[model samples]
Target: MEDSHSSTVYKCHLLNGEHVYLKIPYSNVKFHRELEAYELLKGRVSIPELLDYWSGDEECPGAFLLSELKGQSLTREVSPTVAYHVGVIHASMHAIQPPSSKRLNGIQNEFSNWSAFIEKQFYSFAEDVKEVLEEGLFNQSVEKFKKMNQQLPSPDGPSFVHMDFRPANIIIDGNKVSGIIDFESVRFGSTEVDFTKLYRDFLSADTTLYQAYKEGYNSIRPLIDLDVVLSFYRFIDAFNSIGWCKRRGIEKNTVFLEENTVRLKEFLR
Candidate 1:
């Protein structure tokens, strides 16, 4: 079991020849979010079943166990067939609207206006963005962000979204996606945010896998104005990554951020 940035994962062997993944989260929010999200999406998707969790006392802290999913991560290579299967799974996840009757103690992303939301999200890392950009450049980026937000489509109604849906989180078994792990960033929000990684890699590559993914996702729920949404989110995601790099001291590897900033500047024109 590999260690995630926010948690330590351990493969534990239990009695009756069953193995389970024990995850110890550094933050209570991550632990509870995963627990609640898994509870909400147990049978609905191809995910490792949450077996049990312990909100440990003062001595223990927090821990959870999930039935070990059997598959290899598609980090290196994801065939077109597997990518299509992943798209199908992701579509299913997006299809599951959060039930009004139930409330999980999870992250809520309810925003009244998309413009305000974008501004707030960006300004949350205002200092960090300023750190990497000059005063004029920062103001220019903010102006572009505001203009883009104004043209965004109306709310598409809240839907379940894995904020970090990428190749590393997808598990493959032969030609199909067997498991989708790492639900800590899961939330109910704009469907556009979920397409960030896919658009960045698959869309840019224009590979058969991306075509299969587009076909499969459209087969379930059509991605109306996907290119437009991806365009806006590409900038938003860049701002986020730049902030992350600043926070984590990885400013040297923000080549994508530079490219995204150039695109955002062009979008303003």
Candidate 2:
């Protein structure tokens, strides 16, 4: 049976009629990363408790895991209050300072110097935009971003960042968030990266949500040069999305490419 989102989710009945979520991964590597992240963060944060994971077979290298989630996704129901709470949750996650040894591979190195880190990781993306996208408007926007990148502010500090912080990854029940899922993209970077997704994708130019998120973040840790950090990641994210869509052979992402190009132009200005 298909869920509302058309994802093939299985229900495993546990003791007392409780059910565990068994999500089948699309590929072996994705399964491995998802399971690895679940193991890394099971007891460390408010995530669905992971029970067990197993690979399907040699011919079919995909895998599945049993997890317990107490709430539904917040993407279906979003409001100003939910947005505020999402910000609070995001801030709390970033405040969790894991040991250096515990950090992810690329993230650990980046924590030492975020400016160089972003430049190193995203410079290739800029090149991809130049090569793959032949549109004059997009090319102009990319060039403008390259020049504007010199003026962006540097990171003030390193924090635990949920690189894919968005409504689909957050689970809510009643008025409280029950779980935050999908940590495969977790990294040690500026929290502003996470905030940018919330602000741009979720709030739709609503400054109130941005303010609420900022208040929540400031309550936990102060932000310095946040606008610059947000702008940098926003550009990188735009580039990454276009690259990803191309790699996945998704033609529909042309719209996203155009949208992000315009957004990058505005941010550069």
Candidate 3:
């Protein structure tokens, strides 16, 4: 299948004519993390059934996995009502409290506490484009981001966050949600962080879409100081996305980056 992101994904038919989704991770760590999260949440959520996972090293350089699912992505066609159900699904996932033993230090701490991991694994990406990054527009954007991140509120409780929740990650069939794919970014974080992607990226800021989502979400659980959490995530997301685009040599996404930055600044004010 055609993929928009770095990861390559394909649809293959099995001997029984069953459809399976295959994802080949670009990095070893990401591939392992995807498998870890899949194993952890397999029976708990409406994820595709995993058939197998294989890890390959220098000779192969990555990992690949097979999973079965039965619908197109919700990003293909979304409406206010669809946004509402998406909210419901996200809320449900957050309700599943992970065992204390399973929780790792969050992404925020990963950069600090996991510095060794960062050095061994992630630093290459940054080092590769350090020259481009230093002379780029992103240098100023990063400085502004530090200021915006300071306005975020502390998390109230730890919850299972999809970390990449968005219409593109959801699969739909007719009027119903068939499945959710891509658990690679799964983490234990403020549940509100997950909702930020939906509210800011997927829903188009349409009040009707926002209300529908809120209605479905409130039907399940009460959100605590939700506006504060949304604001926090909005700022952080814009900040992180800008850095990500910079590292990838992406300039067109600057428009989206600037738009969210403005929205976050306004909300904070």
Candidate 4:
């Protein structure tokens, strides 16, 4: 598969011609994070089954196996009902309480608190973008980043958030959401953090779709005040993406680089 996150995926077939996916992640840490996500969400969420695990060799770093999810990638626009169900599914994910730390005072878990995690993430990315960004825009980005706290509402809880939740990771069959794939970026954070990608990719395009999604989310849990905090989260997302493109490759990530560049400018203004 042409992976967006630099992970390699292969569609392997069984003797019965049933398909399974072998995923060799770019790093061991990413592999472990995906493993943790699958183990945690196995029975609760509509995710693929973890079948096998591979230790690193000189040739490959780390890998895992996943059962096939029966659905097409939701790349294009979907119906409001499908969007609603997706909203519900995402809510179920956020409802999960994840571990912030394994042992007492062993390591300061960034996921323990939303505000602190976000602030730490923001500054760390700030150092990366400083190298790639021009002086004026960089200054503007920082100024805008600093002001985000005043606008954002206090997060309800440090919930498990699929940080990369978007249309491409979603699977659909007819009008129903069959499953979601790609769990490498799962983390404990403000539930509000999860909505940024979905909004930018799909929900923001139509009012009715966004409203229906809100209704579905509310059915499972009370919807946060998205209107109050989306811009704040979106700006942070853009800044962090710019940093990613810098580290990965500017030429290869042109679309993402450009999109996030425009996002930063728009938010800064």
RMSD for each of the candidates:
3.4, 4.1, 5.2, 2.6
On residues 13-131, what C-alpha lDDT tens digit does candidate 3 reach at each position? 88997777778765665666677667666776788777777777676535555666566777634576776776677677777665657654322223222224323332343443344
- TM-score: which is higher, 1 or 4? 4
User: Residue 61 deviation, candidate 1, in Å?
Assistant: 6.1
**Mind giving the per-residue lDDT tens digits that candidate 1 earns over 47-153?**
99877889966655588888877787764366677777877888988888868788778656553454566577788877787887678867877887778888888
lDDT of 2: 0.64
lDDT of 2 by residue, 167-201 (tens): 66788877777878765556666665676666566
Best by TM-score: 4
TM-score of model 1 relative to the true fold? 0.84
lDDT score, candidate 2, position 196: 62
Candidate 3: residue 187 lDDT (0-100): 61
* The best candidate in terms of lDDT: 4
What C-alpha lDDT, on a 0 to 100 scale, does residue 86 get in candidate 2? 71
For model 3 the TM-score comes to 0.74
Question: What does candidate 4's lDDT look like per residue over 1-269, in tens digits?
Answer: 76556788998989998999999887766777787788778889899888998877877878988888888877446788987898899888888885545432211234556677788888888888898889999998888777777667767666778889988798888888888888776777678888999999888898888988898898888889988888888999999999988888888998988899898888877
Model 2: worst 10 consecutive residues (lDDT sum):
1-10
Sort by lDDT, top down from the best: 4, 1, 2, 3
Report RMSD for candidate 1: 3.4
Residue pairs in candidate 3 whose N, alpha carbon or C atoms collide under 3 angstroms: none
